[model samples]
Target chain A: MDLTFTPDEQAFRDEVRTWLSENAPSEPLPSGDTADGFALHLEWERKLFDARWSVVSWPREYGGREATLMEWLIFEEEYWLAGAPNRVTQNGIFLLAPTVFEFGTAEQQDRILPRMAAAEELWCQGWSEPDAGSDLAAIKSRAERDDDAGGWRIYGQKTWTTRGAFCDKLFGLFRTDPDAERHRGMTYLLVDLDAEGVTVRGVDRLDGDEGFAEVFFDGAFVPDADVLGGVNQGWSVAMSTTGSERGLTLRSPGRFMATAHRLVDLHRRCREEAAPDLRDAVARAWIQAEAYRWYTFATVTRMVDGHQPGAESSLNKIFWSELDVDMHRTALDLLGSGAELDEGAEGATDAGLWMKGYQFALSGPIYAGTNEIQRNIAAERVLGLPRK
Target chain B: MRFAFDDDQIDLRDAVRGLLADTCPPETVRTAWSNSTGRSDAAWGALADMGVVSMALPVDAGGLGLGALDWVLVLEETGRVALPEPVVETAVVGAPLLHALGCDVPAPPASIATLLDSGASLYADTAECLVVLDGDALRMVDPSTARLTAEVSVDRSRRLFAVEMAAGAGTVVATGPQARDAVAAARDRGALAAAAQLIGLAERMLATTVEYVSVRHQFGKPVGAQQALKHKLADVAVAIEFARPLVYRAAWSLDAGDPDSAVHVSMAKSQASDAAELAARHALQCHGAIGYSYECDLHLFMKRAWCLARSWGDARSHRDRVAAAVVDA
Candidate 1:
């Protein structure tokens, strides 16, 4: 039960810290929701790829350092501490790339992983639909074989597609067999956004950012080579993506730790005028963040020891998503009425970063399977409660 | 870095859990509730024979020099059964405190209660020695030297006593900065031990409630099948799972002697207290009428959780410490 980093880990941490200190952006990049902002983020990804800092845990052939899980965690910590921009390629690199590595053919891996790592072809998730959000198995999106054209034709609407508008590609679950059961009929497909009959309409989030969109597929054709894993086995293949989304890849504890430290700094600056309740809230946020950090450490240890995470990922999702919301809420409380001010408004702090973050945090519980669904999973699978 | 117990620690946990499963079940705890001292000599002797009483004492002091992390699982198992023993106070905190203060007293299998400025002490009457904290110094007083007034705790299994120490009584084991550090270490480790116990208690309470809800029928179905009750219990399970890593991390920090160990300890204690409190509320409510009765075993753990939640350091006090470190820097 040791918490101290080994000398090798410390050395790796130093290397990461040095590189981030030198190469990290001096100011926040534009919002990735915007075209210009997307380009800027792509440039940043190129910088990381050039330095082999984009995906440290992946093998070198896939443009990574093949770093250990501990080293990957150290990289994340340094990445957040340096105030680096959020990974613009996370959807491709973290979510889809792992599935590709696991189930993609060698040709697919060779062609897709490097581009995904370099952020040359950005990706978005296509799981939830207008009809199927929490009840993902109810997806009615259909894909029929186009034997002459050599693949399948997809037709459905996928709503709440994060990065849908800007991303060049998507990996989604399409019902391949209309006669099969709910989970059995689905086939995971990789589709080009520029394909004929694919229309993406950006939806304005609460913060007025078009970070996600509603994607409509009208007879979009996809090749058979784009199918991930076996047809009708998409449920298991997609389950891997959901696992990564909730557990390791999508949200790292370092991001929350950095936010926690920022909140502490904000509290320290505002301590003179901060209310007692706000003080307690700030402290609670810090404690929760620290808990999350240690929890992730234990998780990484388990994963490194060859144990795959199970339903506990649901627990992690519920905790960190709620913690993110509460932490931002505390920040707003410390900011008082000024929290409502815009970026350059008089008396605004951190350019209203907390306000933007609070809005985003609210979406966390809704996405990656809603908290209600996660709780049900935790209840039934983790606790062995009887399913109704 | 490994964030798990080694083979030996795992063995110790299994051994203690097995012993408690046989010797100090809820039935034994309920039986001891009516006893004057609320002490079970048989269970204590069995645990002592397992070396838990001297598990944390230094080797030169005729005991294993095991650290808090090694004995944490043992303390957790004690909470699992609501064992009528001061193992946390005596072995987890007291023995280490004495050894740090250079006390050469034999590591007796009997419990040793600790007296802080907080007034109440655990097993004060049953313990052979009472390690009292006086400002920055520690005084190891013979329990017979202090005037003991028994007080009924919410948890009947825990026999609380208010002690009035005699003037110039006991031996001043250490003073000044060294005493201060030792006292601080004791408080942090004590709080951590209490945290682990609370986690274990919450886990047992949740499991017991889940088992009951599965069998107890209402409105033509088992109560566990109801969404409302299921969700409540699910939240309890999540809270317990989340608090676990915090407890383990706190134990690790204490063992590693991290500079921020105090803050980590406070966080662990605060989270564990909240988790246990949540479990107790939902467990009792889910069990309905039977959970409220003294005849039911659920009340034993519920009451134990309530007692331990306020012991070592309450949530409010620990939160203040967290605020000092995090908010105030």
Candidate 2:
């Protein structure tokens, strides 16, 4: 029942806080999904990688600090508090990396992790297709044996590939065994975006960022070395990644807590003119963040005690995704009509940060498996409800 | 940092849960509803025999001297059965208040009331020693010496009464700043107790509904197969999941005397209140007609949930308190 961090944990927190205070950029960078923004974010990622701060929980051989999960949480809190730029290589480092570590061979880990950590290569997720958005098992993407080339030739289209236009590679499910069942026979592969017959067309997102893309593959060649886990095992492997995406890795409490603090500060600044209702909303939003933080802590504690954290991540997804939306909504409401102004508009509040954030938070529920699907998963898996 | 109870605490909780399961079933609770004092004597006596009545009292007072963290789970089990007793008041808040007030009381339990908002106290009609918070003072009043009027509660098994204690009728156990702090702590414990109980009640409701939905058939299939109902109850389950940690954390915060313990309690109460109410709502909805009637066991837990959710600061009030703490720019 103890909540206080250990002395070593405190020391690590102090060290990171001091380093972040000195090294983190004073001004926020552009969105990492756009070309110019991606270029700037690449530099930030490089800076973090060089300092071994990008992925603190990974093994030291992979350019991480080999810190504990609690310390990793500490780093996130510091990173978000420092207002650090969003990780440009998050697709590789946060989501895919865990699966790779779990399923990848030593050869694959040695080849893939260091480069991804150092920003030498960037990756994007290619899960959602136009027809296979929520029903991911219905993926039509196919990769056939091209043993002559010692790899498979992939042919299909993946839509809503976030940051795909700028990424050099992608990791996704490919139908390898056509005879297998709906959830079987898929192969999780790391595909080179520069491979022949591969095309990435950037799609503009709500915040006017080309972070979304539709990737079309017409017999693109991927090496045999890129197959993650065994063939027909992609469903389980991809489930692990989605678990991370929907769980603690994709959205740590630190980010929301920082935003909540900002919301509180904003209310303080607007105290003279803020309505009582708005004040209450700001407070409510702040509690949601705090509650999520404690929820994560309790979860981490359980995992630390050696409990398998399946399905509960679905619970986390429902909570944080909605918390992000509600918190951002409260901020925009507090800002009133001025929230509509775009960035740099003369009358825009916080450089229209709340509006931009609101638009982005809108995607939280839609992406990483829609909250609807998550609720179903939670009901069936966590609550033992009937699937039918 | 360990965020879970140790083996001893778990053992204590399990023991309390088992004891209540034997001594305080719904039949006993129904019997208590018609009894004079509305107290389950056998259940209370068995619990006291287990030393739960004095578990939180100081060691010098011939008790276990446990903290709220240890008893948090026990209080939850009490709520699970909708235990027709003031275990929260008698043990959790009262023993601590009695200790703080330096009162030389008997080894038995007493119902303590601090809200004093509605001019009524729980179990005030027949409580021998009533710990009452009047203004800036904490008092140990004899309910028999004051004007007693019974107030019927929705959950009839647990009774309430309005007390008209004369000014300075009881011994002024503590006064000024000391009394203020103890009273505030007592109030926080009350809220935390309610929150833990609400969480337990929610779990009971969700389990009952889940069991009912699985067996009851409709439209040629089990009613639980409906996604609408599944998702509704899933949200209830999720609410309970999230609300529980807040209650546990609040218990820890109070046990450690954390400065923001009040805020933690508020968060717990707010979330737990919502979880229980949501659970009750979905349980009834999923149960269809049966849950509306008194025959269905779900109403027993739901009625207790309704009563607890509003007591010791409802969800809205607690959220406002949370807002004040976090939004005080």
- Give DockQ: model 2: 0.71
lDDT, candidate 2, A219-286, per-residue tens: 99988999999888999999999989988888899999999988888888777877788877876777
Report, for all candidates in order, the number of backbone clashes: 0, 0
TM-score of each: 0.97, 0.98
- Each model's DockQ? 0.74, 0.71
Off by over 4 Å in 2: B110-118
**What residue pairs clash in candidate 2, if any at all?**
none
Error of 1 at B92 (Å): 1.9
What tier of docking accuracy does candidate 2 attain? medium
Fnat, one value per model? 0.69, 0.65
